[model samples]
Target: MCAASAFVGYSYYENQLLADTTTHLLEHYNSNYVIQNLQGTVVNTWVSWNLIQGQTLHVSIVNDANLPEDKITAIKDAILSNGTITVDDSLLHEGPQGTSSTRYKGWEGALANLQSLPTKFYIPQSFAISEGSNGAGDVVITLTNDENPDGLSGYTKSISDGNQILKSKITIYQSSQLSAMQLGAITRHEFGHALGLAHSTDPSDLMHATIRTDYPYISGCDIDAIKGLYSGDERSQVMCQ
Candidate 1:
């Protein structure tokens, strides 16, 4: 009887050790990421962009709820055409960093293969809006019929896995508060977040957290932000991550 009791005690001890190890591992994994803001001092947040292999990023939309198909198409188009913006001539000048602060205006190379956004049939409804990547190197957008609190237009949640952006989810709420054109513009703004662009201090930019109805299209600041992100320069002011 004593020997059987001893074996049971040993088994229990082993299980405890395993549980401790697992807990430690989880703590380490969760501690791997951090979030920061760009030049803006506003309450808005941004994530570092993850540049995938071949410098190509794929976009997918979650349409499981059978939301309006036309709206989905509108969002997809907005993403592909996001890099287009007219720069302000007054802001064009070479910065002290050897690269012009406005150099991102000419960054069409990043979107050379820009294509229409596609629809995906499945995506998890529940997810942790965390700091690192969600294990997918692409952007996923979801449309909801629910109302957004605080009279906000839309929001983007990005995940990073260490230094790279693992995944980003953009949520757009459907409401009568916004016309179809305004909704499309909001999608473009969220897509900027998925691309690792932060909220711009300038309200005229689409990357601004609260998009202006008058400046619906992407702006020079938005273009510069993306260009700086993929510019391969370590000192660019528009930083990711």
Candidate 2:
């Protein structure tokens, strides 16, 4: 009788532990932005902010000190139109020692990267470019020689109104050192962040945490992520009306 009683007690203890573990898992799953397939299986995870369609956003360019106006214009042109800007590497002025390179990416390259995404959003000449101005822009692309000890290429900051993006700021570091292709890649990546995309685990993806030096571009998974974000499905937290 004592042996049977001990077996029943052990079973009860195991069941309690299983119940606790399940509860914890459910809480964790519920708190994050989880991506699932039609089969009701989790595929990936990331957080995003929705951008309402037909809302125009203005982007301003703030150049580094002593930078030429034409150089700033090149960046501005790239962001405004899906066109290429011929970069004369020989004409680029020198920057800090061991911190500058002759390569620069064109604006079309970045636009191409964004265009590759299978999203329904359009990029008209909605963004405006500017020089040093006190007025605030919906999105600011600041070029700076800030201390980049970690060798980061670019960074982006954004504000969202719980459901949609209100504004965003993209900072490009060592802009002179980057080749046109690299600049385009970085721009595309930062723009993805501004559009409420999180990093992808795949190294080849444009939204990966680390930008690949070799012509890194967007992937089908990245496209699917954006489509899912705007799909208005149950997995999405923000939906467009």
* Models, CA RMSD each: 19.5, 20.0
Q: Taking the tens digit of each residue's C-alpha lDDT, what string does model 2 give over 128-194?
A: 5666655377767777767456546677766554434556677777666444444556666676665
Which portions of model 1 miss their true places by more than 4 Å?
A: 1-47, 52-55, 82-110, 113-137, 175-177, 232-241
lDDT by candidate, in order shown: 0.47, 0.51
Clashes per candidate (backbone, < 3 Å): 9, 6
CA displacement after TM-score superposition, residue 98 of candidate 1 (Å): 29
